[model samples]
Target: MQATFLIYSFLYLIVLIFLLPFEYFKRPASLRKRWIREKFGFFKKNEQIETFKPKIWIHAVSVGEVVAVSRLIKELSSKCEIILSTITDTGQKIANDRFKNYNVKVIYIPFDIPFAINKALKHFKPLAVILTETELWPNLIRIASKKMPVILVNGRMSDKSFNGYSKIKFFMKPLLKRLTLLCVQEEQYKERFFNLGAEEQKIHITGNMKFDIELREIHFPWENAIAQPVILAGSTHEPEEEIILDAFLKLNITGSLIIAPRHPERFQAVETLIKRKISESSREISFSKLTEMPSAFSFKSSTSVVLVDQMGILGSLYRICDIAIIGGSFIAHGGQNPLEPAYWRKPIICGPFMYNFPFIEEFLNHEACIMIDKASLLEILKELAENSELRQTIGNRAYQLFLNKSGATEKTLRLIEKVIP
Candidate 1:
């Protein structure tokens, strides 16, 4: 092994060993054994790939990445068998659910330790490995690149990520060089990759695959169950829920509030917080869970607040909502996707910290959505709730922008075709 690879591998194993206990215990009891087994590169006999056609291994870190690359995976499935690996349990579940029909095998990504990575690579023997966004696992790239093409699709580099990577340029440069191609989301990401020691010729601006989101005509029973105008706070995090709940309570007009937190593990915590906050308040807002929708649940005459304890339904829920308050922005968590609501032609609201998504600037320039501070959230919510005309105008603009920004998936697929072994 190269000296840099040796050093990184050693350090990575040491860290993994130290954190194994915490990582193992933090998972739910149901997933503990499977998580540990998959992390160490063990797979069932049926999970093994034995395709006559070429096999492609694609790694997406979480739900966002998995969703971003879903279309590409579908396109590739017709050409090659796919081994789709993800790090988070949610990502694994969604990937499995999304590609169950396609020629794709969804599994947890092996621990970055050399032994696990080698075991995985030897077993799958993929023709090419594609990583979504900024997943630059050193051992995985270094080892896999020597055997097969390792490409990065829909790549991006945030300011924080660039600064941290720059500090370790000596270590990162070699890994970046080893990547057969880097298909970035924008010109800024291409420039960042160039600065971080990736050859300029190797980086291509293929646009963001997330832009080419395939919005389905999904109909859930909640579509007709709720009578009040719904304020869906999609993908909310810790303190953002508090802010959203407070803002919803202050709205003059009556409306239901839906809080869909980013992580499923935090569902109970957010539900408890919502119940406590509603109990402490003066208004009569009924609380309920989304799983009871369409049958067991009924919206109270007064304002109703619902906690989304389910997954894979937020995008569909966007169609039923009046206004969408994006989460993760208010507290510098770098905002979730705003395009889902934009696709449904719903007025969107987010905070000022959307650096993770550089394309959000275009929305701001066009005044397609409302980006405000935490203190201004209630004020903005009140205005949107009261003004139907204003909501329609903003929602229309956002849908137009979304329509204009598609075709990224086609662009990325053409580039991948060139590198496929």
Candidate 2:
């Protein structure tokens, strides 16, 4: 079964290489590493660390996972030498920037081929391997388990993902059993993993690592200068921006509307949408020009919208928002993280697609957050904007919920210590 799975994995990689266009291959270095696997070797020569002895290796796939485990990384650094690996360039960038001061090495995870997995293991020789979220690379898990302990931290299994894996349960069962522990984010995820042949004794509910992120004070350039209520539409996707703009026009509130698209590549597209919606009387503000305006003028004028075209600023930008409309929920894209806004004590408004984050739904239920389905967004926005008392009440409740869930980082770090040699 393992041999057949390995053959199928190779075929899948071949299909991906052929189907994806050359231009779409944005990360040349990653592609090069994969191609090296097809030729003389699986892992790149440079990926091998000769002298660095890592106590633990943590794999975080992308930006969300990187942010989720960042606090845990800091806490675990005291006891172990941490090696962080990510598949995406954005994740690598975030990890490098965040862990620059610490004794951490960030590397790109090689392809999941057997040779690549073996090579990575032989070089790092980590005491244990920890994977964040739903990163289940079969070969990596199998090979790493042979030499050292392997665990999944902040593990979660969506119903859709679970169903997909169940089809290959014959191959998946052994892969799962090799894990030393499965630190799950929620009880439902824990139960689902167990149903899919995961050992019950290996699973534990550690809560979402995102809740573990500490809220830092962000000093917005307009913090003291602006009194106008700022409405932040964060991590928004296509079509949703149109809905938000229409709702914003209806409210006609005396404030700035900041739209931060989920992907940096969508900046120009979102900017175009905002330009089309804004009236000729209103001016759009850019972050670059934020310093030119006078203290009073920053809040006084009819600057209708601000487009956040850069990365690494959305979380900090949330500090200035009076109300937050989290994107990705409007359409059926499952939702983006809402905890950032909740941490900042801002009342959150999201669309109805939130299955990816069940804990967030629980938080919203307890806090009485403003939830608007795709159809009723306009009405919800108008009501929230008009009623100051209602918005503040919900905002305060959201912050209180954050305060209650503050210790997940400490809890997760303690678990890491138990596993590390």
Candidate 3:
């Protein structure tokens, strides 16, 4: 099984090298040696290696996974030298920022190629490799398991991902067996992992670490900060933004609309859409140029939209929002994390495609959230925005739900401690 995995890894490496030109042209900065060293598995000789031996290596694929496992990292840092690795630039930045004060080293996980993965493992020499969510790198898992224990923390297996993995059951069965322990987010996820060849004795329901994140009070210092009741369309995709803008336009209330796109590259696109739509509206105002101080309710009826062109602020923005419309659901991206807004005690509105978050969907169905199909979003937003009492009622229910689900972090940490030798 290991030999076959190595052969596959070698073939995958050849494919990656063959497609290097395309990746280089698409993102030259991303493929730079220094950037690759930091973001990918490539390491630099000049870069100083930490003197302290890292006891555990934690891998989070991107920003969402990083945010999901951050609290657990904090807890594990005290007893172990945590080595954090990410696949994206944004995830690396967040990991570095969050772990700067701790005894943690942040690096990019190398390609799943055998040589790259082996090189990284030999250098880091961690006691265990801890992967967040579903980052199942075949070569990495196979090689690391031969040297040190590999554990999956805060694991979640969506039905879609499960079906995809099940097709390659023969290849993944051994990979799943390499995991020393599997700390999953939910029992449903445990069952999914079991179906995918995970050892049932190794699986534990640790709950969702996202529910474990500590909600910090956000203070927006902008002069024309959104003071009046605001509705945030967070992590919206291309067509979803237009839909949200249209819904906000038909709303009966005089409040601000904040649109936060999921990807940073989409910032400009979202900004352009906001400009075009607001220009056509009769009483539209953009908050991007709000430079001067204004009374709390002064710009209540003035600014119609605020495009959050920055990243890492959406979670904070949710704290002050009266209602939240989670994006990606309407357009079939399986939806962004609705738990972020739910933590703020704000009433959430999402489209129908929420299979990625089955537990959240179940909670919403039980009145923990407000579900709106694409066709009904406009009417629901209009109703919620017009009635402050109704918004508050739902918001309070969502907040309670968030509080009820708050112990996942602690539960996850306990499992990590038990496995992290």
Candidate 4:
């Protein structure tokens, strides 16, 4: 096993080196620098010479995971010194902004090479390693297991992931057994882990921490910004904007529309597409980014489509929407997040390809939300626009379900304590 992981690490290093040229040119400056520094275990000045008492290293890959572990990090920080690490620049930016006041030391997680992991382990001196959902790196976990507990928090394995893991049972068994603990999202996920060779004693079902979502749209002036019923194509993907824009023109729904593309890099592309589509509409369609609008927003009565070209604002934007069409589900990217709209107690609609979030099945099964193909999306939007009572019932049902599933953070904290304590 040791020999295999070493060879794996060597091959991985080579592959990264090979891809570096392309990545360096293509990615953002901050991201490229962060990736390079993290690849070689470069630590900042403050990261060096920290307090020596039992440090808990919390690793969340990006924004979603970083945000999910907020309550967990907050609760655990008081108990033990915290060292938070992320893989992406956006995640790093968000982590720094969110936890800037907190005493937690935030840094980038090194690439999964043995030497890089060794350097991180030496500097941080974490008493325990708490990994967020589905981040099972072989070399890092294998090395850390020797010095301290390597626990998996908010662990979940989707069917697509399970099938891939099952094929590599030989490599996975040893990796699974090294985990000091496993806090999974659902009971069914336990069986999937076992099939992938996790020890039964190590696994515990703890639901999703996302359900315990602690965000406030309390400040967003919905009444001022939203003149009429609005349809928000929140977190949309490539070509999704065109389809939804077509639907909006046809419906002539006499309301505002906001399309927030999933990636910031695509904001210009979406903006251009929306501008072209607005040419076909007889009703004057106004287009603007969130930043372009006035602070004391008074939305225009004429048909308007606002392209949300910013970050950390989408969750708050949900409060202003009458209906939400989640992105990524329409394409093979799986889905962005239907849960955000649900958090705002708004009626949500998504596409058929939501394999990325199978946990949402129970919510969809109970008809708390609607999932339709891209072709049928217009029909449902039209129906929901007309039927006030139906929209209220569906939104209320999803909201109730979201409230009921709120204790995962508490459950996860209890289990995590058993290891770090």
Candidate 5:
């Protein structure tokens, strides 16, 4: 078993080295330096650590996972020092900026190699390591398990991932065995992991921690800045923006619309798309990016749509908007978080492809959110706009579900304390 593992590790290392130049050069200049630093595990934050001291290590790969685990980290911060690591630049930025208020040491996690993992483990001698959602690193799990319990929190195994792992089930057994426990989102996900060589006894269904998110009341400047109710289409992908524009045009009500694309790189692309849509229409309308003005800023009489090109303000926008059209759902990208809008008592319109968000089913069934064909988006928007009471009914149902599902984070905390406390 050890021999086979070593062979696989060596091959993985070869692939990593082969792709180094391609990956390194592709990053923008601002992030290239950080990439270089992470490659050597030379993060400035770990410089002060000279010896083995007990801390908690939480690894989240990107913005979505990072946001999902925000409340978990907050509750755990008071109990122990935390070393948070993220793979993407945007996730790293949020980790550093948001977690600075707590006992968190944010750093970019190095690639999954023995040397890099060893360096990170040496600096922060954690009592336990918590990996968030589908972050199954073979070497890191195996090595860390030998020192302390390594738990997979809010674990999920999609059908696509399960099929991939089942093909390599023989080699995956050793890796799965190393994990102390699997706290999964649902029973189906736990069963999927078990079928993929995970020990049935080691997996527990803890539900999704994202449902237990702490919703903060943020006063958005745009909320008071505009004269009419705002419709926000947040975390949108490619053609989703165009769909939103077409639907808003169908709405008989007069209100400002904000479209925030999911990827930072697509901000310019969405802006261009929106401008073209505005110009093609016969009616005169105004447009601007959210970064252009403050809360006190007023829109021109003809101003209608605004593009939120900036990051870290989506939550605030959710608090202010009357209706939310979550991005990624309208396309094949699964779905973005519906809980964000639900927390603010706002009705949501999601696309049919919501496989990524298994939890949204309850909201849909309870009439907290509505899912329609992209073609029917116009009809739904028009109906909701005409009947204020129908919109309120959807929002109320979703908010009630959000309240009922508020205990996942607390449940996860108990499991963590059981292992590490």
Candidate 6:
């Protein structure tokens, strides 16, 4: 164990040192110092807690994982003192805003080095560690597990990840065995974990926590500002936007179109692409940013294309739109979550590549959602736009499926209660 750790530490330090300059320069000027300090296990505030409850450390890697466990954190907050750590700056921002009222201390995760991990563990002094999804930091897991439980909640293994991890099963087995318990999303994930050296007895299929998300009732100005028959191309990637925009133009719909790119860094580039495309077209399509419009502004007779530049509002956009187009699937990128739109009973459509979301297969089997190719996108959109009854039928089916899969959170919490103490 010592030898493996030594080799791992050597390789890890080398890579970290190599990437330090690139990572430092990539961050905004104001956040560079804070990001560097936090990653090295230095925190600004040190306070004492008066509560007698056991302290738990929860780590989520990024936005998706953070949002998946939002409600779980809320429920756990009242039960214990919580130290929530996230890797990405965006995830940290969302967690802070989402859990501002709760007793959660949001911070950046420490680098996976012995000294850094030791500092974090000593400072937090948590009784147990709850990790979201597939965050398998070797040093953190190995060290923390020696003292307390290191549990994985809402765990899943995609085909891509499974193939990659399978190649290094020798290295993964020790880390997987160190985990006291694994609460996975599905039966397949349990099988995958077992194959990767997690003890079968220690792994449990607890369903996905995302199904139990407590959606906020958002009231945004876009709700009233946008025109009717609105089509939302949500969580879109590169070429998908171009395809959607071209399809909308060909369909010549007289309603609003909202394109929400997946990454915040791409907002300006997407806006430029939209403007260039609109300028070249002969049609009188107007384009604007969602942030710039007044609360009560109305679109003219021609078609309107609005770019969503903000973060954490995709759920609200899904609620107001008439038809939803799931992005990322159009390209090789796996699809985004469809549950948000399903929660609002919105008719959903996506491309063929949805391997990231294995549960989507069930939706397709039940006829709950529509899956189309790039060539057929225009036809499907036009059909759904014209046929209100078809849209309602599909939306109702998706909503029913969503309700049927709602108890994962309660099951996971019950399992956590058994081991947390």
lDDT of 5: 0.83
- Please report the TM-score between candidate 1 and the true structure: 0.97
Against the hidden true structure, what lDDT does model 1 obtain?
0.88
Overall local distance difference test of candidate 4: 0.83
Using Cα atoms with residue i matched to residue i, what is each candidate's TM-score against the true structure? 0.97, 0.89, 0.92, 0.95, 0.94, 0.97
Task: For residues 242-317, write the lDDT of model 3, one tens digit per residue.
Answer: 9988878777466788788888777878778878887888775655622232344244445567777766767877
Off by over 4 Å in 1: none
Whole-model Cα lDDT of every candidate shown, in order? 0.88, 0.76, 0.78, 0.83, 0.83, 0.88
Full ranking by TM-score: 1, 6, 4, 5, 3, 2
Off by over 4 Å in 6: 45-52
Better of 1 and 5 by lDDT: 1
Give each prediction's root-mean-square deviation over alpha carbons.
Answer: 1.4, 3.4, 2.6, 1.8, 2.0, 1.5
Better candidate by lDDT, 4 or 6: 6
Write candidate 1's Cα lDDT for 1-421 as tens digits.
3887788778888898899999999888998998898899888777787769889999999999999999999999999999999988899888888888999998889999788888888888789999989999998998898888999999999999999999999888888999999999999999999998898898998888887777667777555667567899999989899988887887756778989999998999998999999888887778888887765456775688889999877887898899999899998889999989999999999999888888888998898999999999989988888888999999999999998988888988888888884
Expressed as tens digits, the lDDT of each residue in 297-390 for candidate 5 is: 7777544898998887787678877788988998788888888888888899999988888888888777789999899988887777667788
Model 6: what TM-score? 0.97
The reply for model 5, stretches above 4 Å from the true place, is 44-46, 49-53
Off by over 4 Å in 4: 30-34, 221-223
| CA lDDT for candidate 6 | 0.88
TM-score preference between candidates 2 and 4, better one: 4
> Which tens-of-lDDT digit does each residue in 275-301 have in candidate 2?
667643254433322334444445445
Clashing pairs in 5: none
